[model samples]
Target chain A: MSTTTLQRPATPSAVHLTFGRVVASEWRKLFSLRSTWWTLGLAVLLQVGMAAILGAAARAVAASGQGTLPVDGVQAASAGLQFSQLAIVALAVLTITAEYSSGQIRVTLAAVPRRTPVLLAKALVLTGVVLVTAVVSSALSVGALALVAGEHISFALPGAESARILAGAPLYLVGIAVLSLGVGALMRHTAGAIAALMGFLLVIENVFAAIPWKPLQIISPWLPGTAGSRLMSTDADIAAAQAVPHHVGAVLGAWQGYGVLVAWAVLALVAAVLVLRSRDA
Target chain B: MIEAHGLSKVYGTTRAVDDISFTVRPGIVTGFLGPNGAGKSTTMRMIMGLDRPTSGTVTVNGKPYVEHRAPLTQVGALLEAKAVHPGRTARQHLRVVGATHGLGARRVDEVLEMTGLGPVADKRVKGFSLGMGQRLGIAVALLGDPSTLILDEPVNGLDPEGVIWVRDLVRYLAGQGRTVFLSSHLMAEMAQTADHVIVIGRGRILADAPMATLLAGPGQEASRARAPRATELAAVLRSQGLTVTQTGADTLEIVAGTPAVAEAALAAGIAVHELAPVRASLEDAYLALTADEVEYHSGVGAPANPEVAR
Candidate 1:
């Protein structure tokens, strides 16, 4: 049993590799990197900070009683989520791509050779961390505004409507993280996967809108970014316009938006699973 | 135990691993010997279930690695050293890997100490030297206390002490009735360490035999004669059931020792200008075995005479 004498115990215990163990392993892997902390920290700051800043600005406008554009409390609470989505995406992409890029995927697969468990474990861990952070950030943003500037903010919707926004925002962010993880699993290169995910979300929808063809412009609403934004924004028109300035009233209803985002994530995850199952690690 | 039947892999236009069937049994140190790009790593990956065989199958214990409930306990593999995130420390890397199979922190710490990585366990792997990285890889492989260990180039970048340590460690493990299947391109090391060897060349198994058989087998010998009659001498040697390949205008390399070839030539009345036995080191035996299968043959001499790839 001396450490210097490397002897594998003659009889190994009847230990099975459970899914819980894989989840624990993945959770450890996720937090062990500096990028995870930096990305998570930056995401929380941006989410809470931007929400407070936007809420304060709108409150100042309402105090003057002249030029205040009505700001919904939920929208004000999640105003920073748009920018912080990049951080969540980064964390998700790194979840899968870092393994591939560093050759750790081989080690991971060798440890859990069933493959699907690894992907599932990663998705679960990512969802858990991102969902918790997003929920906390949204709650803090709303709480901070209520403490400082809640009196001036006009109702986007009161009671349950605002609560829906708070809940839906975290779900939407988790969906994006899952989708990003799928993309990372497929692309396997950190830069390439991140570029593909971000480019599709940020640039492709705009490109579609800029096309002079009306039929092509209609394709933008079904995109992951447009759909996710709908979940965060109470006004579908405003969310559509925000994602692509000229695109107006093209966003799905809140439930439809959730469904589309879920569909996108599921479709991506299924494809990623197939690729992982059939191809070499 | 590890078993493969008609295991092969094809990458685009190249056959990375041709139909190779071999079994690596427990209680022995089996050296997977090959030149670079000889499909040794590919075979190892296939065994680990990291790569799917295009046409065949490989199994560890009694099932494919993926089918095993406890793959880490069944087989420990070091496919590459430093296959870790650069930002994570050595201990963190081991712990993360260990967590998959419910391996405890105590096991991780033990491996860290055993591999001489305890001192730098908390240092980021990006700063690790090649030797340290190799040790970390070994520790990860050992973390599960696997019954079968597959290590690819475990001695690479190690100092003399590390190399000896690995040698003794593997031999000791084999003595304990554990399977140690490790790959290396170094014939000298393999000869010194392996109880058995499976030599491969150009994705094909060139020789699968005991270490003694591989070392004592027929090797290339150069027998020289007058330039005018060298071709005749080669033909005469060939007629005697010896493989004679033309090396130079006046020199013929036969796959036999000097005495047999020289006696035949002398009996045939072909006066040999010179007859010398080329000392066949294990390295020479390897070069001779894989003379024609080398993908990137060096410019020097070019093996004199190449064997026909089977």
Candidate 2:
């Protein structure tokens, strides 16, 4: 039906837009940029490298038999998250913000006029890519910790505690990545969105959690950063949060913390969708 | 075909696109001509659904652009040049946009070659000159093989060769029963390519007519009189109640009949070197039609519009 009769069917052939194809388009866009791989690689390296380093320190302290090791082997394996999450934050922000910086959003919106699907597709691709990175790096981190400080920290993968720790690491990373994606869409500027997310994760959440007040402590667990951190914590870590004389608050479990993080992501995503549809591209 | 009914856009308090309605028919090239900040881009954006109209609606083919099952197939648009992520290679950019419509690599390569961009298909778009970027934009507009096309300033950054290529391409597409709507600041270029023209100014439609009728204007016959003593001929013609404007040292644009100018020159003993009737070109017609509508005027004759903006 698209045949032009004389010049190569200028209108081409039968083809139409689909949700599946938009997902594919998002995939291609994410992989085409060199920054995506470089930043993601940094995230993996930070996670694994921190796990091994923290595991060795835990082993040394135990060997001397002097003081209580603050973090267990499970916590050590995921400790790299402290630094690796920054990489995830940067990557997620760039995923959506780069389009606006380069004036490509207009072209993208033109292709997919419904607007909401573009954000959904981008979130899906980001989740898929970051999940793979988080899983592989987190696993390697667990292996490295077990290899170096296995006996000292009683590290092994077969137990329920270790399994939850391993699984939670990737989910936590994916959550942070999706959360950053929504913020980036709302703020449309790379540095500005990164600053806002960094402030929320590093400054605001930590400040409220540190204040020695009951109500603030109670509400701290609801903060996305504090809630998300619960996913990677060991029993010792949870106990420490409670032991703080000012820590009279709800003790969130791993999945529960992850659910809170997911809720934050959903809130940001819904706001992005509404703003994107109503505002001019 | 493209239809707009009372489509308007208000950015903050400024009416970027006022209430304007027009039809762009199939099988013809319709030129959207306007001065800077005259709402051409805003109108085109409203039609493409890039910017929502505040008051009314615009539709491509038969329904609103967003309602179409395949928007790219319905109307491919190049609203601005270089609307691409510079970090990605040219081929990658096309592949990503085309994938939304389920268009494959074969078609991607076809468009790359068609736009004369095959050699640089794999190169990042960061280094492309303005002309190359324009070609890439046109390449994107053609990716879906859409039946209706909207290109705003399609030849803004093209070289002479590229300009001619776009003209011939638009004409050929329209000849094949496609709807081609384009906006350009180049008056001579529109005069050459567009069969019908829509003149817009200050967010309003000032003139919408065929090429010939617009150029012919409102039956105000103008004659170009060139004589050795043009000033003397002007004085004689002015006394006869004729509006005359000195276009050159020897040539005068007289808003009168050719016979009157000749008779005045003959009576004044001024040698008439040349005298003939003149039809306004699109540029002249446009300037005359938009004399009062220009947003910003250099000399002190036109009023300034406080609301128009980039």
Candidate 3:
């Protein structure tokens, strides 16, 4: 065609921009990418796969010992956090870093010029999606563990400690994801942000937690990665760590560890929003 | 309407956009004309609130772009083509941006059809060609049914047909009593589509006036003349305080009327073979305007860029 003209709608719509609408837009943006689905799916697979193997090992140990090996089914289900957390790292980091890499940040900033609303909306969407996905994946991993361990593990409704432990998996995963998103926003590069986050969550946290030094031991549980994972620890899991020779990590309640992770997320988000507000798109 | 007052942006020591002010009124197309590094895109980005100006204020409609109740409705800017995630389909990207203003899927589909991207609405942007990417960008800009459109290099990657389509589309939008501001380095394109023009060079306003005034340019009539000794004739014309540029081996274009050139050649010893008045084109005016800017911004700009295309 040589040329064409657009016909505006006869009646113009009265658009009212609200924070909820921004959140909705961010939700659409997150779901439209295939990477979001693949990474989340991998998290579920890793958690369930680890649950199965760990459950089988518990059953084998019980058979060899001539005694019942006490297995917390929920703990076995979430045993793969170390591996699955990496998937959430990739997903959350990509959520913001991909926008920067592809130059879509300009379009987004132009649409919502207030700036803070955009990052807040992204954080809200990331938290909501990760919370739901983590909850469902935890349930699936529990089922896998119960199936592999048979009667050796109980899937019955839990006591307070077990309930907290069961809820901890999703809570910890969501915390890590939101934290990663903040880091992504601050770094503004896909590979750099992902590597920075992965290094802290995987190597740095573990290294500080296992060094068997007094100050490192005291500060270890306060690190987001170490403390956040502790959110899924049952009472027996805490006691088991206490039993380890020259234990180099702090012993904190599940909720308290989750609180520490939330603090880290909040601090990162504040920094990200500040940087976003001050920096040009 | 868009109004910028004393707007300026500085990157390190370079003044990307100097303290400049201009107004783009509704019901007419305003062509933002500039050279390759003329800060046209930077100024557009500043208007869109994508880049914060170092000093100055710009407002769209009646308020700053960020202050609008619905920014997208007030102004739709195509800051860059392919400012989209490759993994998402065109429809998905449109829907995502549209959702920010509470726009629904119906409007998204309407824009897809309007931009002639309906067939590839569901296709991932990664596989789209440059022209397709540009069309998708226009669809996004049109999604909100915005009253003001700011397009930076809208025809950058379009085919001939697509280029004509955008030229017509912007003209149509301006005719609808909306404010349409588009930037381009193509002088001929601006001459065809714009009713008003603002020419920029080296981050400063070189000229701003109606299209007719710009083409008339400096109130000088350009005349063409051929002489046996053209160089001697040029020296004599320069002595008479007339601007002259050598166009060919034996021809000179004098910035004086045909009578003035004939009188000067008659007074001199050069025998004039042919003499006539020539119409000044937008390209000539534009080149002349930028040629001055290039000289003023020496070292950074070439002395003469005769090969700068329209």
Candidate 4:
């Protein structure tokens, strides 16, 4: 057991109260809670499980020489990442919304009066955790898949394509996590945030895609999940450009897709911060 | 010290808290007295920045709560019985809050010990009884050794022993020159613990004065004259320009100058069977102030008082 004596100076200096301290405090809070560990564990499980199954299936097809590899080995290895994104998104939303549900958000805001710093701190920590987990999970998934499949499926390591996939996968997850976190702040309810996230990803975006309106088709790639998915699969753009009628690259250039995803993440985060600062917890 | 300047809050159409203002001074326990739904919780929430006021502002020391650097070090508040996640252990909860200010594990354990939670600090909060949860909330309030403390109904679920402990704890905190502001409908408890009192009724300030003054003031003297056949006394007092009411057949309440005056009247050949001075209990005074503003009046008839029936 640890005991702390009262050590506040007779007069506390202003230097001790800063955004840096808030960030540090938020980081501690983010990791100290048990939910963080659970989410990370789920991320790892999904990454490894999805990668192994897809790698095995790809290897069987490649060994028989039945047809050219339908997807790149790296992409196959990272297939599980799509499922793991849900866990990351859930973790991010819960980090803020749970406080609201339990009536503890007021305590948090009281402790740190500058609401933006608190939100920013949470976002930074979420991004850091999600990125680290995504990278490590992607690496392990790819490595394990290669080991199981043998030499038939080979992908260059640290190469431009591999780097893009590796870097972009985590970035995409972090972007999605931020976007969800913003929505969570705006909604201030776990059920509402989760519902909105699912509605946007599963229903709204698809509805937009199915619409016959030409303008809607042009705007479809800007949807949060769609933009994120394309960003993580840069190689798909090159493949679609050669084999498909509707050139994916023309609809949204590689850089343009990345920009759209980042813009969505940033816009959501800004709106969340504005609402958090101006409105009551 | 904590000060509120024209603080008010509105929830849609209902005015939860009106333009009320009061001050809580250091080195004393200030009891915020009100019945249920008197905006006590809403006012406290605003002070903690959990709820933004519709108008005006509240400041601890000289600045708003959010503007204060080292907020945990400046003020500690126990606004709820169990503002904790069930999966986290008591020690973990303390440690997490402590870590915000860069405090070490030692501080967490000290607070656990202080609140008598050391034995169960390792246990998950899910298994805690209501009393244990209240203790944890107090422990969190004490975690920062803050100079200002705000506790809303700190004794709600406490056992007898736990209740006594909280009483002593608040007194001790005040003794250390800290500002302790607490709200409770338990007037007896407030009578014992608070040095000053702030009574709110329907989100408006009904009274703010020293506990001694409030207890010995107008309301107390009026209730002392209630008794059967006291209408004669009311008639006599009315002739003397004193406001009087016959509460019951045997009760005549007189809001006269003082106990000595009422005693003098009885001595001057008044048929006074009961000259008992109705020193208003804190409970009576509180009810009197908030009676009109009680949001949910249970219309169920009161159970017959056996002593009164006799």
> What is the TM-score of each candidate's chain B when compared with the real chain B?
0.80, 0.91, 0.83, 0.82
Writing each residue's lDDT as its tens digit, candidate 2 over B1-310 gives 9999998888888888889999999999999998889999999888888888999889888898987778888898988788888999889999999998889899999999998999999999999988889889998999999999999999887999999999999999999999999998788999999999999998999999998889888757889988878888888888989999998999899998788877778777889878899987777788777879886777565334332221
Best by TM-score: 2
* Each candidate structure's count of clashing pairs: 0, 0, 0, 15
DockQ order of candidates, top first? 2, 3, 1, 4
TM-score of each: 0.85, 0.92, 0.88, 0.85
Q: Which runs of model 2 end up more than 4 angstroms from their true locations?
A: A1-13, A59-70, A147-153, A156-158, A239-247, B229-232, B241-250, B268-270, B301-310
lDDT computed for candidate 4? 0.78
Cα deviation at A99, candidate 2, in Å, is 1.5
Scored by lDDT, model 3 comes in at: 0.86
Q: B143-233 in candidate 3: lDDT tens per residue?
A: 8789999998888889999989999999999999999999987788889999999999888999999999998886468799998799999
Model 1's CAPRI class is: medium
Instruction: Give me the runs in candidate 4 sitting further than 4 Å from their true place.
Output: A1-15, A63-65, A156-158, A210-213, A234-236, A239-250, B220-276, B300-310
List model 3 lDDT by residue over A1-281, tens digit each.
00011112223465746677778899999999888999999998898899989888878877887654456787788888888888998898888899999999999988888778888888888888888888888899888887878877765435887788788888888889889989999999989998998999889888887787888878988999888877777776777877888656567777788899999999998899889888888
Q: State which docking tier applies to candidate 4.
A: acceptable
Clashing pairs in 1: none
Q: Rate the local accuracy (lDDT) of all candidates.
A: 0.84, 0.86, 0.86, 0.78
Greater lDDT among 2 and 4 belongs to: 2
Residue B157, candidate 1: Cα error in Å is 0.7
| Candidate 1, B1-310: lDDT as tens digits | 9999999899998999999999999999999988788899999999998888988999889898877777888898888989998999999999999887778879988999888888899999999988898999999888888899999999998999999999998998899999999998767888889999898988899999888888777755544444458999989989999888788888777778788987898799888887776656667677778888888766686552232111
Docking class of 2: medium
